[model samples]
Target: MQTQDSRARPLLIYLHGFLSSPQSFKCQLMREWLTANNPHIVFCAPQVLPYPAIAQQSLVGLLEGFLRSANCGPVGLLGSSMGGFWCTYLGERLHLPAVLINPAVRPSRFMPAYVGRVLRPYSGGTQEYRLTEADVDTMGRLEAELAQPLHSRYWLLSQRGDETLDYRDAENFYRSQRQTVEEGGDHGFQGFARYCAPIVEFLFNQQ
Candidate 1:
């Protein structure tokens, strides 16, 4: 199966969590694993914008660019936290398979705490942006998609010790899909490197 991919470069795009970047630990771990084991696969972890509307736009643009590139093959998504939420939106829209790690069920439900606060954006530089009502509203629109049944193409990875968001919400949200519920791990998700192989297999082998 690995050699078969040599004929066509399969892509694995990782989406980092909020206030995180392509260099985040999970992103780096995934990136490093792919580089060492799946040389035929193209790994992409775009630095998504902080704002909801533009973040979606950036993801879309990345996908488009990848699809247009030569030797493009099957595309899969892997997202953590907020990125997992956006990944669901994109995966459902395109009927693509995705691996979600501690995804936010309803971002708008807890987004109020972030509004109007001067927050550091991704890539963690000096520039900061205030979370606004418009950003939160855009998130609501994305959340609205959850009202319908989700495609059973997701592999959910959640930890009960997640302090920021409730693991139960994700369990209920993705009840129909595959999942891994671990105990005593925080929102960052402990020992994620352990699942690196299965994650690639699930995403890459999916149609």
Candidate 2:
């Protein structure tokens, strides 16, 4: 027989990509889906700091707070891009399952070009922030601490036509885990709606 805690609604945390916000397309899609089909499940997509150093602090605080508040239910993570990296770290540390979408295996190697001024594509904000070397170093440190795969605890989703970050890196990194590789999709993971069902199953239905 399932205990009350075991049957409690699962909390789903959606971590958006770098330079993105909770209002991102994928985040919004998940929100809408939960609101429509699974009203009992709580969905959260907190805005993370743009810089790696600040984001590390903020993200941890958010997760810690959630863990304390939701004491009786399971929690799952759904992360895209840079957020995927964070999900992997948090999942391993918290011993929770995570679903990564076109995750960045080594963002530190590519963060140099973005060290200066950058625009927020999702939010129509005129403000731009200068990324720094310290930020890059922080990312490097986090990347260095990557946990060995818990194949049963992860689900990696990649697309062959991703233009921003190469999919091969993630494929190679998560090959031992459950993965779904599709053809002719972009960095945004076009047709994301189609995968919504599987994503939900990966997060909540799997034992």
TM-score winner: 1
Tell me the spans in candidate 1 whose CA falls farther than 4 Å from its real position. Answer: 1-6, 68-70
Which residue pairs collide in model 2, if any? none
* Per-prediction CA RMSD (Å): 2.6, 2.7
- TM-score quality measure for candidate 2: 0.91
Which pairs clash in model 1? Answer: none
Model 1 whole-model lDDT (C-alpha atoms): 0.87
lDDT of 2 by residue, 42-134 (tens): 898988766887888887878888788745367889999988988988887677789999998899988888787665646666656778888
List ranges where model 2 is wrong by over 4 Å.
Answer: 1-8, 70-72, 150-152
For candidate 2, give the lDDT of residue 131.
84
Q: For residues 31-73, write the lDDT of model 1, one tens digit per residue.
A: 8888899877889888877788888887877787777777679
